[model samples]
Structure formats: C-alpha cells, structure tokens
Target: MLSAGSLATLFENTIGPAFDDAHEYGYRGEFHGSNAVMRMVLDEQKQPDVIVSADAELLRTRLPEDIAPWDVVFGSNALVIAYGPDTAVGERLEGEEPWFEVLSEADAEIARSDPDLDPLGYRALQLFDLAEQYYDRDGLAPALTENLVIDPQEAHILARVEAQERAAAIVYKNMAVDHGLPYVELPEKLDFSNPEHADYYAQATYTTEDGTTVEGAPVLYNATVPSTAPNPEAGRAFLKFLLSNPEMLTENGLVVTDAFPRPHGPVPEEIVP
Candidate 1:
C-alpha cells in the first residue's frame, strides 16, 4: 500500500495495529508524503494496493478517471507556522508584529515542498497569500520565497525547521504536533481548517507547469484505489478498514471527515462505501 503522512499515522497508530491483531490478512504499508505518492500514482510505476493523499486535487488533476474512481475524504488538517523555539524567527514570532516581517529579515529561511508535487506546497503558497492580506505586506509571496527550499514532503519541512536549517516552515498542524515541535498559533480564521472559510481560502491558487490550477480550501486529505490496481480486492478491503475506524485516527492528531464525498465524476463502486 502507498499512503500519505496523515494516513500513515492512521495506519500506524490505529488501522495497522488493528489489522495486525485481526490477522485474517496482513499487508505491508509503504508511507510516502503526499507529493511523492501523487508522482507514483501519476507515473503508473508501482501499483500498490492503495493510495491515500493529503488532497483530492492531485487525483483530480493528475490521475485519469479510468485510473481510479472513488476517493474518500478521510481526514482534515490545518496549516500552521512551525519552527524550533531556538530559531531566530521562532523567537520573534512570539511578538504581536506580523510574521511576514520576521520572515523578511536578512537571515530568515522559509522551507516548503514543491507545489507541483505536494498539496501542502500549494497550501503553503496560499498561507503566504493569506498572510499577505492579514499582515498587509505587499511583497509577501516573493519575500517568503526568498529563502525557501523545496523539501520532499510536509513532514520533511518540519524536520528542517526543527533542525534549525530554516527559521520556519508552513506545515500541517498535525505534523508539527506529531513531531512535538514548538509553533506559533495562527488565528482560526487564518487556519484552513473550517469549511466556512472555503471561499476566502479559495482565492488562493497555484498553476502547475501543465497549466493545471489547484485552488486552496480547508486542508482535506483524501484516499483512493486506482482501477489499474493489481490487487483491487485487497485495496477495497483496506479502505473498508480505514473508513470503518474513523476514531482510530483521532489519537494521531487527525480528524476524519464524513464518509467519502462523491468525486466530480464516476468512481469505483467497490471503494465508495
């Protein structure tokens, strides 16, 4: 199985352990960050029994309808400014001054993933745009990108921040807490965790090299099994296990959304329920 970091926690802390104890069947899960899994699914290289992603936009834009059908909105997360307590920016973020000002400093470094590859990457851009409005910084995007490096995934970005390689990085709230990293809290209005703010957040979008555009919203994580999957039966079974145990994910700092929302187009029936 191939899955995203959020789902990786779900499987590790809940699904994996539960499934292990059940022992009626056993499957090895290979966890990759959202971007990497999208790349793998798009390339059709490794047909894992399943694929879970941090955003459905990846599947909508990259994977063809024939490749997979239903995607479940298994959980939700929010973006937060994460940094180590010892870092310069982290220290300054404690104050009332806007975060962009601190990040604009000469020595500050901001880290993020590649937008074309990761949803968090695009979401990071959205957060910057929101911060631009929230802080009234005209050059926030360019300034934020000044010291940015593309980490492989959201978790990796937090790792860099914790290591103090970068002063701070925008990442999923669950990830920073999962790693026990100290972080400044963004207002709930700024945090992309509520559906009501969808329109405000939707104003932020990223256009990929292929000219595909992804608009931002509350951070929702999705999962799907491709039609080309080598083991559709196993994939369906695994998904069934995941959806049935939503509470298992809470311990890992994730919030499972309602049942899989229907996709824009037709989806595989087996995985839908």
Candidate 2:
C-alpha cells in the first residue's frame, strides 16, 4: 500500500487493523508513502507486489510504459488550513475571518512541500491562487509562498503544524481531523473536493519551468501495479480488496470516490481486472 502524509496515521490505526483481521484469511500487505513508493518503482530497485499513491499523476509520469495501464481512484480527500491553538496565527484566526489575512501578515510563518516534487506542494499553490481570487487579494499567492519553508516531504508539513513551528500549513481535511488540529474552512468554491468545481479548478494552472504549465484540481490519490512486480497476482488481489473494502477505508478517515472504470495504461491482461 502507498499513500501521502495524513493517511499514515489512518493506515496504522485503522487499515492496519483491518488487514490484520483478514491476515488469517491470507490477506497481507505493507503500506508506504507515495514518494518512497515511486522511487522504488522508478529505480526498479524493490518492486513491491502492489503500488498505491496519493497522486495518480506520479504513476502517469514516473512509471514505465510497460507497467499496468489501469489506475484506480479508490479514495478522495480535500485540502484545508491546519494549525494548532497554540500557534500564534491560529490563535488570531480563531473566528469568522479569512485565513489569508493572517497568513499574509509579515511575522507569520507558513510551511509546505516543494511543488516541483510533491503534489501537496502544487495543490498548496493552487489553493492560494484560488483564495486570492475569492478574496480579491492581488498578492496572496506570492505572500503565502514567501512565508513558506518547504519540507522535503509532504508528511513533514504536518509535523511543522503539530509542533507549532509555523502559523499555518495546507493539509488534507482528514489529516486535520485526525490530528484534531484547529482549522479555518475554505469556501467549497475554493476547497477542491467538489467535483463540480473540478473544471473551474482545473482551469487554473501553475507554471513549473519558465514556460511550462500544468493544470490543477483537488489533489487526487491513485494506485497501480508495476510490470516488474514479483507477485503480480498478489498485487492485483490486494487492489481488488482495497476497492471492495470501502468500510476499511472509511475507518481510516478516507472518502471513497464514485468515479469508476479508472484509467489505465497497457499492461498484463491478467491484472487489468
């Protein structure tokens, strides 16, 4: 199993138990974050039986073409402003006020991952851009970006929020809830969770290189099996189990996506189902 930061707690506390419950029944799997999973797959170093990711795009971009084509959207998540009560900025933004104002303040500190490497980082940038439009603030994106110090991995951003090292951090809704952190909710218009707004959000793009741009939307988590997987049969079986077990996922604080017939690339036919 592979995932992003917030899901770590859920996987350990919830999903791990479910797998254990089925362990005697012959269900066994290991979970890791998307970054580590991707590196392993890309390097052809240690090909696990299964591959799941917090972002589907990683599979699209990193995996070899000969790998399985089909990718599934088994779950979904929304981003939110996360902070603790002890945080100086969190304390100040406790009421019905826009978080951008507090975040833009000169003394405020913010944290995020590098967009170039992590989808969370890119989504953070998109959220700021959306907030700027919603609030009519001209420099909101730059202001938020300027305040941020990038962590090497998306998971570390939560640590910064929990440690109160930063005033605020952009994180998934489930993460904030799981950590019991105080958060200011962004309007659904800006919260990328609503698929109806996907087209609108998707229209917004962030330029990575000088002239290259990528469209944006709510960050999506995806999964696939690699061609090099030593136990392709086991990978497919685990994928099937993950898709069929919505209750297991909800116990982990995940919201399953209704989208079906998940996209895939050309791979072994045996594992396609």
Candidate 3:
C-alpha cells in the first residue's frame, strides 16, 4: 500500500489493522508525499496494491487510465502556521497578528516541502500568494518564498519543526494537533478549509519549480485502488473499512467526510453508508 506521509499514523495505527481484520493479513504501507508515491509507481515501476494521496485529484496527472478511473475524497484538512518551541518569534505570530507580516520578517525560519515534490509545498506557496491578496500585502509572496527552506516532503518539514529547527511552517492543522505543536489558527480565508472560499482561493495560484500550475483549493485526502493492483478486492475492502470507520480518522485530528465529496466514477456499494 502507498499512502500520503501525512496519513502515515492513521493508516498504520487504524486503517491497516482494520484491513487485516478483514483480509487475514497485514500490509506495510509505504508512506510518501502524493507526488513522490505516484512517481515511484510511474517512474520507479513500484506496484503498490493501494494508493492514497493528500490531493483529492491523486488519480490525475496522467495516472494510467486503467489504474484508477477516479479518486475518492475521504478526508479534509486546514492549513495552519505551526510553531516549534525554540523559534525566536513568539506571540507576534499568534492571535490576530497578521501572520503574513511575521512570515516576511527576516530571521523567521520557514521550512516547507518542495512544490515540485509535495502537494503541501505548492499549497504552502499558494497560501502565500493568497495572503498577498487577502491582506493586500504586495510583497508577501516573495518575502515568504525567500524565507522558505524546502524539504522533499511534508513529513520532513514536520520532522524539522518537531526538532525545533524552524520557528514556524505551513502545515496541516491535524499535524500540528497530532504532534502537540502550538499553532496559529489561520482564518478560513487562509486555512484552505472552507469550501465556500474555493473560488476566492482559486484567485491565487503558484507555478511549481517544474512550471506546473497548482491552483489553491481546500485540503482534501483521497484514496484509490490502482487498476494495476495485485488484489483489487483487497483495495476495495480497505476503502470499505475506512469509509465505514471514519472514527479511525477523526480520532487522529483528520476530519472525516459525511459522504464521498462527489461520486467519483465507480465506487463500491459498501462504501456509501
């Protein structure tokens, strides 16, 4: 199985066990960013039985048509500013303080995943671009970009923040909560949580290092069974388990969906309560 790094804990602790309960065997999930995991499948010729991604459109980007016709949205997340204890900048990044300004402040260490490698990376950059419009801060995007030290994936950024190597970083809200990291609760305008802001957020977009256009949208977690999966039945069973046991997700700080975001082509009947 391949899963997004952010969902590593959930899959290992909850989803995998549930799968084993029904399948008679346990599988070790290879966790990586959505992009990296897909890259391995396509370039490295790795064939994971199941695939999950932080981006709801995981099946996009030229995934083999037979591998996955559509991706299903299973969870949602909000972006927030997470702070490590050792960071020098304190309450200024706290309540009602314009986070854009603090991010622009020199000496504020910002580590983010690489836009070309991790969806979170591009999302973080898009947040900066959105901040430019939301706060009308003309140079906010460039300033924040200048401060970022890119990691290969979101997990790496989390590791550095956990180690207190950086003061603050743009990360999923659940990540901050799960790690017990105090965070700046970003407004819906910035958090990428409210679907109502979808169009507003879309106003901001970022071109990845490879020049791929990534538009701003709410954070969503989606999963799918690859057409190349060795056991398509097992993949379907796993999705059934997760959609049925959403508590397995909510308990971990991820917001479970009441229903599939939308009918994504074909899905198992068991998945739709």
lDDT digits (tens) for residues 1-273 of candidate 2: 545555677666766566657644334344444555666667776667667676776666666567746676677777788876776787778864568777877386777766665566677888888878877889887887788777766655677778777777887777777777877777876777776787878766776532335566655666777677777676676666566677766665567655642556543445334
* Deviation (Å) of 116 in candidate 1: 1.9
Q: Best-fitting candidate, measured by TM-score?
A: 3
Once model 1 is optimally superposed onto the true structure by TM-score, how far is the C-alpha of residue 235 displaced, in angstroms?
Answer: 1.4
Whole-model lDDT, model 3? 0.76
TM-score of each: 0.86, 0.84, 0.91
Badly placed stretches (over 4 Å) of model 3 are: 94-96, 209-211
The candidates, ranked best first by TM-score, are: 3, 1, 2
On residues 1-273, what C-alpha lDDT tens digit does candidate 3 reach at each position? 887777777777777877887776556788777777888888746787778888776456647667677667888988888887556654566444677777788486787777777678788888888888887768878988898887776665777777877777788877787788888877798888877899987887777555667677878887778878887776777776777777778888887665544547676566545
- The TM-score obtained by model 2 is 0.84
Off by over 4 Å in 2: 24-39, 207-213, 260-273
Query: How does residue 139 of candidate 1 score in lDDT?
Result: 86
Find the candidate with the highest lDDT and give its number: 3
Q: Model 1, range 136-220, lDDT digits (tens) per residue? A: 7798877877777778655456777767787787777777777788666676557788878888888888886657787877777
Of 2 and 3, the candidate ahead on lDDT is 3
- In model 3, how large is the Cα lDDT of residue 211? 64
Give the true-structure RMSD of model 1: 2.7
